[model samples]
Target: MSDLDASTPRIFLARHGETEWTKNGRYTGTTDLELTHHGIKQVKGTAIQLVGPGKLIDPGRIAHIWVSPRKRALQTFSLLFNNSSSSIGDGTTIAKTKVTITEDIAEWDYGDYEGLLVGEIRAGRKKRGLDSETAWNIWRDGCEGGESAEQVTERLDRLISEIREIQEPYMNGGNAVDVVLVAHGLILRAFAKRWLNYPIDSPLPLMFSPGAIGILSYKNHDIDEPGFYLGMALPLQD
Candidate 1:
């Protein structure tokens, strides 16, 4: 068995590939969009680099996959597992991995700010006599008429609890059991913060690029000590 299998379980957070809105810097919450041609290639490349036997994300070890309800995230999941014939692994790993489409991992609801760029949002807020002196910060001010940081924290905390429950059993020496979350950029960043017990409203320097993957795991193989992986070596093949 690989050393990773004997260590703490991990959560693989995958951001969906680029869309026209994403590339153009628009807030994409609740506005379901498809991936562009380039986006498809990006995810396929990530799969080749990360998802396979003896790779960072060996799909056979993934216990559960929580995907956003949006089509973009769904497309990413399909491409990552080679369901679209992108050909990363043998294509049988997904069949054994449990996948769920959930709103819990969806992007932060941008509401009135949906489809608008950051500058546009700020201008609109100023026109409406909101935040006239200060610029708009989604993490602190949140989107107008949309969810707040506290609300996002509530939902994410609940989902984190669920993920912990799933991983607790196999955390100690056993078969590798990991969880995968396919979602949007902002929310995934927020999720990472929450995983480390950090407030979502805090200054977040985390940057999750399009089609990027981030790993979260317990430190020192202790479930009580959650931490993010800055870098990890590949598991040794038996």
Candidate 2:
């Protein structure tokens, strides 16, 4: 059993809201795009859910809020936590506490096919008997100039290590420490894979709709022998 399995902490992962490429099903890696109007509403909606009853995360108690350096992610983080009027007045406000930007949390590098649509890529690959399924799953086989699932796993592992350092100071405290991460789709899924202890190369059976949120926490009663608990909220389509 790895150390992550032993001291798993509660974390909230929020995928950045929709972008032009996202709505059109293009490979949106590394490219910085703004949130559509609907995307903005989704972020605010998720924020409201977090701030309401039965879900209130005490601002004063949150351990850390990490965000991807991408413009979209940074903007989402700002909109979510920068509202002083909506703040609970307990923990550090968004403006006061700079949400740490982590490169490890950025989207997967899509390489040669960065802006291409799935169908377009598939049609071209089909000329050589390759199809969409075979290509999109390229992470398993490795894509040209793109990071493989194994490489992404390495980055996710590093992020988990950083989380451990944060836990060292709070081990004795009975209170729960919460972390919120504003990141990209693939990176957020990578984090999920880490939390679940899944093989990164294993089929990405998981899908994160834009603006969706997930909770990573322990399920078992025993802290010494903790179990991973994953809760996913589907992104609103309409």
Candidate 2 achieves a global lDDT of 0.68
Give lDDT per model, in order: 0.86, 0.68
Pairs that collide in candidate 1 are none
lDDT of 1: 0.86
Candidate 1 per-residue lDDT over residues 1-238, each given as its tens digit: 5545446899999999999998899999999899999999899889877887667787767789899999999999989986433343354467633888899999999989999988999888888898977788988888778999888999999999999988888777476679899999999999999999998988869988999999999977788999998977776645
Q: Total clashing residue pairs per candidate?
A: 0, 3
Give per-residue CA lDDT, model 2, range 1-238, as digits (tens). Answer: 3322223456778888888888988888888898999888887887766632124443544678888888889878876776422365344464445368888888888777689876776666677676645555655654557777788889888887676566545554555466778898877876877766777766657788777776666554333332344543432322
For model 1 the local lDDT of residue 170 reads: 70
Output the lDDT of residue 133, model 2.
59
Candidate 1 regions with alpha-carbon error over 4 angstroms: 1-6, 84-91, 235-238
Clashing pairs in 2: 59-91, 60-90, 60-91
